[model samples]
Target: MEFHSQQPIHPTIRKCIQHLDVIKADDKTKQIVYMYMESLLRERDLIAASKQEPIESQIHN
Candidate 1:
């Protein structure tokens, strides 16, 4: 997904994704980085949610 100027991710997250000063990332590289970042964010959210839910609820069927 092409991330627009404004989206669900925070400005810092977007900026970090957009501005990686390494060997100079082209469009494809940027997209790859963004995808990786998105996945990381998704995982982070899942972990946070798991933590937020009660341990009993998490263990229950």
Candidate 2:
């Protein structure tokens, strides 16, 4: 997807893209980096979802 001026891309994501471009020949390293990024995204998503829940309900659970 094209990142235009209207859509702000995260700085870390941009850096990862640039890093992957330079290591295209190393599949193992690329896989490790990709997984690390995926885990971070998942953690961020979980945090965001938790914030949307009511504090009372979260405490009850």
Output the worst ten-in-a-row residue range by lDDT, candidate 2.
Answer: 1-10
Residues 8-40, model 1: lDDT tens digits: 876666786657644566767777777887888
Error of 1 at 61 (Å): 8.0
Candidate-wise lDDT, in order: 0.74, 0.69
Clashing pairs in 1: none
Q: Which candidate tops lDDT?
A: 1
TM of each candidate vs. truth: 0.65, 0.60
What would the TM-score be for candidate 2 when compared with the true structure?
0.60
For model 2 the local lDDT of residue 46 reads 97
Q: Over the full model, what C-alpha lDDT does candidate 1 score relative to the true structure?
A: 0.74
